[model samples]
Structures are given as C-alpha cells and as structure tokens.
Target: MNEWLIGLPEDQAVFVARVAIAFVVCLGAVIGSFLNVCIYRIPIGQSIGKPRSHCPSCGRMIPWYLNVPVLSWLILRGRCANCKAPISVRYPIIETLTAMLFLMVFQMWGNPAIFGLVRLQEPLLIPVYWAFAATIVVNSAIDIDHGILLDRFSLGAMPIALALSGFFPGMHGESVWTQGLIDSAVGLVGGFAGLWIIGLIGSLVFRKEAMGFGDVKWMGLFGALFGWQACVFILICASLLGAVAGLVLLLSRKAALCSAIPFGPYLGASALIWLFWGPRLLDWYVSLIVPAAL
Candidate 1:
C-alpha cells in the first residue's frame, strides 16, 4: 500500500481517502433510503418501487429533489411538503445510522485498492458487509415496528450468504471455496437447530410459545453469514440484551411479565457487535480464563 502511494503527494492521498470515505457514507445513506421503502412495503405486501415515494397522508408524489436521504428530511422539516403532516423521525435516523455503520465497516474491513481510500485488504468484503448490515438494519426496524421478522429477509438471505461465502472464502476465514461453503452450511444447521430446541424447551416450561419461529430462521441466517461459533456467542449476547430490555419494560410497567417482546432487534444488535468486536472480546475472555483454570 505504501509503495502504491509513493508517487502520490501526502495531501492528495489524504484528500482522496477522505473523498472515498464520504462516497461510501453517502452510498450507504442512499441504500438506507431504499431500505426504508422495504421496511414499510415488505410487511404490507406493497410494491416498493412502482409507486415511487409519496406522502402517505396527502398522497402527493415526492419529488426527487425532496427525496434525498437525511438531508431531504432535514430540509423538509420532517413534514410532508403538500400536507404539512409530520413525518416520522425514523427516516433520517435510519439513513444516518446506516451511513455511520457503513463508515465503521469501511474503517475495519475496506481496501483502498477498490477506490484508493485505505490500505488494501479485501475491497469486495466492504460492499458485502455493507449489504449485510443494511439487511440487518431493515429487519431490525421492521421487527421493532411489527413485532415480526419476515422469512423473506431471514430465510431469503441464506442462499445468498452461502453463495457469497463460497465465492469469498475469506468470509469464513478459509482459503478454499469448499471449506467456506461447508462452514456456512454447518452454521445454518447448527443455529436453526439450536434455537429451535431452546424455543421448544422454553415452551414446555412456560406453557406457551416461548419463541417465534421467525427468530429461529433469523438465527440460521446469522449462521450463514457468520458461522456456528458466532451462533453460540451471539445467542448469549442477545439473550442478555433481551433480558435487560424485558426487565426494564416490566419495571416501567410498559409491558407485563411474560409479554412478548421483539427479539429480532437484539439478535441483530448482537450480530453487529460480533461483526465489530466479538472475536477480539472472545479471545480476551478466553485468555483471562485459561491461566486461572490451569
């Protein structure tokens, strides 16, 4: 990477890197705009594209000038241009969140070779991770709004994840396509079965459906993208998160004891945590325990 930059002046290099980063952030915001459409339309069985963006209250088509992701929302003052009806703040929040997540992933995994921004690693992984993050965000948002996780987002992503793993063996930290595919398959089966078993046992103990089948499938998707090892770690993390959230809700009297709460967001959040720092944290935890156990 240094050799490639030898002929380039330092200031030019810095400018180019900054531009590339900005481009990715903007790209992510644009994708997030589409994701908002997916979140609203997918569950409702509406076509995401055909009608174009419009004010739901006034039924006025949104002009492209007014459709820019975060900027447009701010410019519009969070209201419909025609109706003056207040729009949900979620739009800009999702767009900004996606943009920030994209920048973080780029800092962690991006290669300047793709666009001459950062040191070369695997540039392809950048877009793959970006798309994965976007999907997770859409799923989390929808689950929060609807209390359901769509099979299309969970089960639908499995095959694509497997294909990506096979093509980019680095996805599974493997050198060979076969190994990557095998790892993904193992993760899919393990996560699905593990969660299903747990849900079954919970139902037996609680005398009701203890977990949504949607979550079981979503875990499979998680396994497909990550691996079986991640499945265990993420399950633990998500469980802890869910417990804390449920406890808070109960104490606040916002939700009754044993009331159903959306678990998909916790799962998605834990997966993102794993993407950012799970392996490092896991290694640290093991290092602390090993000598003590010995």
Candidate 2:
C-alpha cells in the first residue's frame, strides 16, 4: 500500500484515505434509510419501494430533502413536515448506528491488504460483512417489534453466504477456500440442529413452546456466515445475554414469567461480537482449556 502511494505526498494519501472513509459513512447512512423502510414494510408484506417514503399520520409523501437519513431528522426536529407528527427516533438512530457500525468494521478490518495472495479480493469482504450486519440489524428490529424473523432475510442470506464462502479464505490456520465452505456448512447444520434440539427438549420438559423456530433459522443463517466453531461462541454469548436481560425484565415487572422475548436481537448482537472477536475469543478459550495443546 505504501508502495502504491510512494510517489504521492503524505498529505494526499491521508486526504484520499479520509475521503474513502467518509464515502463509506455516507453510503452506510443511505443503506440505513433503506433499512428503515424494510423495518416498516417487511412485517406487513408491503413493497418497500413502490410507495416511496411518506408520513403515516398525514399520508403525505416525504420529500427527498426531508428523507436524508439522520440529518433530515435532526433538521426537522423529528417531526413530519406535512403533519408535524413526531417521527420515531428509531429512524435517525438506525441511520447513525449503521454509520457507526460501518466505521467500526472498517477500523477493525480495513488494512492495505486483506487476502495474502489476492490483495484486491480482500477488501470486498468489508461490504460482504456490511450487508450481513445490515441484515442482522433489520431482522433484529423486526423480531423486536413483531416477535418474528423473516425467513426471506435470514434464510435467504444462506445461499449468498455459501457462494461467498467459495471466495472466503479460511481462517484459524486454514487458507483453503473449500475448507471455508465446509466450515460454513458445518456451522449452518450445527446451529440449526443445536437450537432445534434444545427448543424441543425445553418444550417437552415444560410442555410449551420454549423457543421460536425463527430463532433457529436465524442462528442457522449466522452459522453459515461464520462457521460451526463460531456458532458455539455465538450461541453461548446470546444465551447468556438473553437470560440476563430476561431476568431483568421479569424482576422489574416489564414482562411476565411466561412472556416471550424476542431472541433474534441477542443472536444478532452476539454475531456482531463474533464478527470482530471470534478469533481472539477462540484463542483465549483454547488456551484456557488446553494449555499443553499449543
């Protein structure tokens, strides 16, 4: 990378890099704008594109100027221009969150080169993971709002992940693309089977539905994106998170003992964690469990 910039002045290189980062942030915000549509439309089977953005209370079409992600919300004071009705803060929040998350991923994974041999092919993974993160966020929002995960988003991403696996260089001391695909397959099957089995057992013991099937699908999808090894850590992390949060809700009377909580958000959050920390977390676990193996 330095060699590519060898002739360029240091200031120019820095300027170019900053511009590239800013572009990513802007793009992320736009994607978040689309996500707001998805969050509102997907649950109702509405076409995300046909109607364009409009105010629900006044039924007035939202102008392009008023629809510019987070900035628009701040400019309008979080109210509809036509109706003056308060818009949910979720709109700007999602936009800002998506932008921040994109920046975070770039900071963590962005380097001069990604793949050892295919330098150009490596940076493509950034957007790949970005879409995955977006899908997870959208799915989590839906699950939180509607208590369901769309199969179209969760299960639909599997084939894309599987295809991407062919190009994904395997990590964890493996570099073979075929090995990467195999890891994804293992993760998918293992996650689905593990969740299904646990849910089944829980239901049998309690004589009620202990878990939603949507969560199983979402987990399976996550496993496909990462791998079977990651599924273990992700499930462990999500379960603990869900348990702690559930207990808090119960204790605070926010929810009843039998109330169902959306589990997708926990899973999504865990996957994001694994996305950045999977390798380090696995290394730490292995070191603790098998000190002599290394």
Candidate 3:
C-alpha cells in the first residue's frame, strides 16, 4: 500500500508526511476538546451532547468561536469571557497532552511495518492507542476529582475495544484478527480476575473495600485493547507509581491513614507508559525469565 509513497521523491515524501502529521495532531487536540466535556459532564450526569460549552462559574453559553480547543483558553487569557472567572489550566493541558500523545502514538506506531513510509495501516491504528490514552486521561481526572471511577467511560470502552481487536489486524501485535480476539479475550479475563482477587484479599484483610469495583472494570477495558501482557505491565507500573506517590504523601504529612487516594490515575499513568514501552519491556522480561522456564 505504501510502495508509491516510498518511491516518491524524498522532499515530496517529507512534505506529505509533515502535513499528515499536522492533521493527526490537530484531530487529537479536537478530540481532547471533547474529552474535556467528558471529564466534566460524565461525573455530574450531564449530557455532553446537548449543552454548548459554558462557564461553570457563570452559566453563560460560550460562543463557538471562543471555544476553539487550546487557542480559546489562551485567547481568553485563562478566564471566562462572561464571568471573568479563572479557567482551569487543565483544559488546555488536556488538549495539549492529547495532541502530544497522539503525535507520540503516530511516531511510534505510524507505519509500523514500514518505518519511514506512510501507509493506510498506520493511520488506522493511531486512534486505537490515542483513544486508550484519552480514556486514561479522562478517567484519571474523574477519579482524582470524585474518588470514584465512572462506569460510563470505562464500561463503554470494553465493547469498542473488543470490536477493534476482533476486526483490526493492525492493532493486534499478531496482525491478524483471529489471534487478536483470542489475545484480547485472554487479557480481558486475566485482567478482571487478577484485580478481583487482589481486591478480594485486600477487603478481607483490611475489613474494608480495598479497591473500587470500578477499577476492575476499567482494567478489563484496558486488557481488551492492549492484551494481557500490556495489562500486566500496566499493573506492575501502576503499583510502583502508587507506592512511590503514597510514600511521598505520607512523608509530607499531607495524607493521613483515613485519607483515600484515587488509584485510577496511577493505573492510567502506567498504561500510558506501557503504551510506548510495553513491547520492548516485555521482550526484556521474557529474556530474563525464559532461561529459568526452559
């Protein structure tokens, strides 16, 4: 599919590639804009679709021209035009982060089979990873804000992920849907069960709910998209992150025994890490463990 692109003049190819990359980045920021809507409305049971963007401080409807992704926030000087209330920097941050993550996914997985050549297969898979990252962003923010993961996004991602795994060969490491579904199913079940066991043990030992049920479902969604190996990586990474952050909070005396921290953000951050480094890390782990197994 990309043979022609490969054959193009070097200068022409560079130009085309740059243009395409810009498009992808722009799309990502736009999606991030919608994600901000999701982050805010999903927790409050508000409809993201019906209401136009408005100021939380003052309920004036934001004009469409003033709602342009990252630019609007900067243009408004980080304040609401109507109420003069300060806007949260997280809005632009989310949009920028989404755009950056989108670019990273494209650069990493873009034209995976043919490193430098642009192809149809590459662009298709970019969104799969981006959506994965975006989910983490939204879910993490919600968890941090509310101390509970919302079922709406996490639960909704499951079917979407499975459908992609079943049909999109490019998304599968195997590059085939049959194997993709099998791998995805394994990851889904394994992730759900693994966390369930941990949660169960924690609850029994602590005489309290150690982990939220919402987190279990969230991991299941992640498992379906990236498979069991990635899920495992995410768990390991999240654990380390949680431990470090928890210790820091304890040392600073900012966190108390009864004070609860949201685990979802750590999990999401770990997933982001794994998204970029999972395959290489998995290979390294196998190399270390394979000799013992043999």
Candidate 4:
C-alpha cells in the first residue's frame, strides 16, 4: 500500500496526502457533531436519534443547513436561527477538538500505512483508535458536566475491550490471542486494584472520600484495552494532572480545599497521552535515568 505512495512523484504524493487528511478532518467533525448529541442526550435520557436537532429554547427543529458542524455554529453566530437563543460555544469547540484528534490518529496510524513512504503496519488500528478517541471525548464531557461517570461507558466498555484485545492481538504487542487476552485481563485487574488502593489511602489521608468508584472502573476499561504498563503510566500521569488542576483551582479561590473535583477527565486525558506518546516518553525517561545510574 505504502509502496504505491512512495512510487508517486513527491508533489503528487503531498497533494494526495493533503486531500486524504482533509477528508478525514471533515469526517471527524461530522462524527464529533454526533458526539455532541451523545454527550447532551445520554445524561438526560433523551433519544439522540429519534428527535432531530432542535433549539432547546424554542423547540424548533434545526434544518440541515443549520446543523453543519462547526461552520453552521459560526454562521449562526452561536445563536439558534429560530429563537435567536445563545448557543454554547462548546458545540464548535467539540467539533474542532474531535477533528484535530482524528487528524492526529490518522497521522499516527494511517499515514505510514496509507499515505507515506513508510512501511505499512496494521491499517485496522486507524478506525479502532478513532472509536477510542470518540469514547474518551464523550465520557470526559459527560463527567465534566455531571460529576458522575456512566457505568454504560465505563464498566460497559470492559467486555468490549477484552474482545477487541482477543481479536486483535497486535493491540497488546502480541501475535497470539491467548497472550493478548491474558495481558488484557492482568491489566484490568491491576487497574482496578491499583486505583482502589490509592482511593483507600487518599480517604485515610484526607478524612473524606478522595476518589470515586467510577474512576476505578474507568481505569479498568483502559487497562483492558492497553495492558498493565499503560495502566501504570495513566495512573501516574493522571495524578499529576489532577494535582496541577487542583492547585490552580485552589490558587484562584474557585474551589474549597475539600471540594470534590471529577477525576475521570484527567484519566481520559492521560489515556490519550498514553495512546499517542506514552511509550516513547517512558523510554526517553528510562534512558536518561539508566545512563545516570550506570
């Protein structure tokens, strides 16, 4: 696959790659628009599909023209065309974020295999990673808004993750189904227990609930997908992120010392970092330290 691209003239290859990326961006934004629907409707128990997009203020059904992802929001000036109600800027932001994330995934997995001169690897991971990215966005947004992680997204994803690992053993850096399943199961148990113990210690130290059970389950889902090393990386990275965020909040006087902050979003962010650069970052750090030790 990549050989064809490599054989093309450099100018033509660049044009072809740009065209492919542009298409991916458009598709991502469209999917993101649907994700916005999922984020809004899931919490309220509304059917995301049956009811067409509508203005919440005036109950006006949005036409196709008014529903074209980020562009429509800009054209309408962040207001509903019918009632002139102020629309949240979050719509465009979500669309943009999804578009960018999708592009990154394409660059990471699709570029070498389909667009560039590099060797082709697993092309199937492109769609898998996209789905993973969307899941993170939806669940993170819901957690930010509701302060609760839905079991449907967290615990519900565990079996699916395990199944994927078994089917695509390459996900776990293995070629055999049994080894992949074993690694996934180990990570799952490690993720759950690791967070549970940390939560216990935090409660003891803070004399209050310091972690939500939802976060534990969320970590388990990631573990099932990525394996034990990723679980450890996510745990460390998320804790640092949470600590930094908590410090900023405290300094700004926006929250009390004991106020509860949702942790799922941090976990989601950490999962993404792991997906993109965790292994490389870990290797870099190890190299620095190992040389010094020796």
RMSD of candidates 1 onward, in order: 2.8, 3.3, 3.0, 2.2
- Residue lDDT tens for model 3, 205-277: 9999988999898888778878877777888898898888888888988776325667888888988887787
Pairs that collide in candidate 1 are none
Better of 2 and 4 by TM-score: 4
In candidate 2 the C-alpha lDDT for residue 67 amounts to: 88
Give the higher-lDDT candidate: 3 or 4.
Answer: 4
Estimate, for each residue in 1-294, the C-alpha lDDT of model 4 and write its tens digit: 567877888888888888999999999999999999999999999998978998899999999988999999999899999889999999999999999999988897776735452323376778988988999999999988888888998788899889889898878889999999999999899999999999999999999988999999999999999998999999999989988988898888976742555889899999999998877888898999999999
User: Model 1: per-residue lDDT, tens digit, 1-294?
Assistant: 545644578777777778878898998899889999999998899998889999999899999999999998898899998899999999999999999999988877753434444322366788888888998899998988898988888898899999988998777788899999999999999999999999999999999988899999999998988899899999999999988888898788877643555888899999999888877788899999999999
Tell me the tens digit of each residue's lDDT in model 2 across 1-294: 535644567687677668868988998899999999999998998999889898999999998987898999999999998879999999999998888788767656564422123222355678887888898879989988899999998788888877778677553234788887888788789888988998999999999987899999888888888877778888899889988888898888887642555778988999999887777788788889897765
Best-matching candidate per TM-score: 4
Could you estimate the TM-score for every candidate? 0.91, 0.89, 0.87, 0.93
Give stretches of model 2 more than 4 Å off.
1-8, 113-121, 171-173, 247-253, 256-260, 291-294
Ranking by lDDT: 4, 1, 3, 2
Clash pairs (backbone) in predicted model 3: none
The alpha-carbon deviation from the true structure for residue 55 of candidate 2, after best TM-score superposition, in angstroms, is 0.3
lDDT of 1 at 74: 94
Whole-model Cα lDDT per candidate?
0.87, 0.81, 0.82, 0.88
- The C-alpha local distance difference test score for the whole of candidate 1 amounts to 0.87
CA error at residue 221 for candidate 4, angstroms: 0.9
